[model samples]
Target: MAEDMSNEHSQDDSGLHAWMLAWYDHAVSVGFIRPPFLLNDVTAERLEGYFRVGLTPVEGAEAFFGVAH
Candidate 1:
């Protein structure tokens, strides 16, 4: 029924960000998807995003996922 919206293409522009923020708010209000939540905290909803998007093993496992700090 609600096939009007298209989240396929990413609008990385600043203007798009603002527009999407408003759109997300409205969509949540109308029950399209649940509200956004943090990944660290085990809350209502958390987007895994990409399952296999982490470090490669053996070759340079230590360098992978390394922080600047």
Candidate 2:
């Protein structure tokens, strides 16, 4: 049962990761600013915290991962 729960959690995480990547790509394609770094360090919890603060994903990514050039 624990193994099954772990698998489910993994699947959910992968799904969220895929959605976030796709959303970021689309945002950039539409002229949203890209972050200085890759999304590799971003996590679901961090993203959720941004959401709770009322930022759109694009804004959240910029605020959390973007560096001034």
Candidate 3:
């Protein structure tokens, strides 16, 4: 059976957004965001790619986000 996802994108800029932020924070704590996230500025799309492809190396992560080496 398919999971119910009707409200997945419904609560934008609300509690759902906060929950997403919490998930990001968890990722940071688990070293998923890497250090100096400010300098790198990883976007959501790039992060999705990281999850899809697995193991986003520092160089690849930098290049993926268009950060100058």
Q: Model 3 reaches what TM-score against the true structure?
A: 0.32
User: Per-residue lDDT tens digits of candidate 2, residues 2-64?
Assistant: 999999989867766665675577567656546653544446568756655667656766765
**Evaluation by TM-score, superior candidate among 2 and 3:** 2
Model 1 global lDDT (CA atoms, 0 to 1): 0.34
Q: Which parts of model 1 are misplaced by more than 4 Å?
A: 1-12, 37-69
lDDT of 3 by residue, 1-69 (tens): 133354543543354345445545665665667645553335655544554454434433444444466
Question: Sort by lDDT, best first: what order?
Answer: 2, 3, 1
CA RMSD per model (angstroms)? 15.3, 5.4, 8.1
**1 or 3, which is superior by lDDT?**
3
Summarize candidate 1's per-residue lDDT along 1-69 as a digit string, tens digits.
233333333432443445435544554565555756222433111111111232122212223223547
Q: Candidate 3: misplaced stretches above 4 Å?
A: 1-12, 35-69
Worst lDDT run of 10 residues, candidate 3, spans 1-10
Give model 2's TM-score versus the native structure.
0.53
Question: Model 1 Cα displacement at 53 (Å)?
Answer: 31
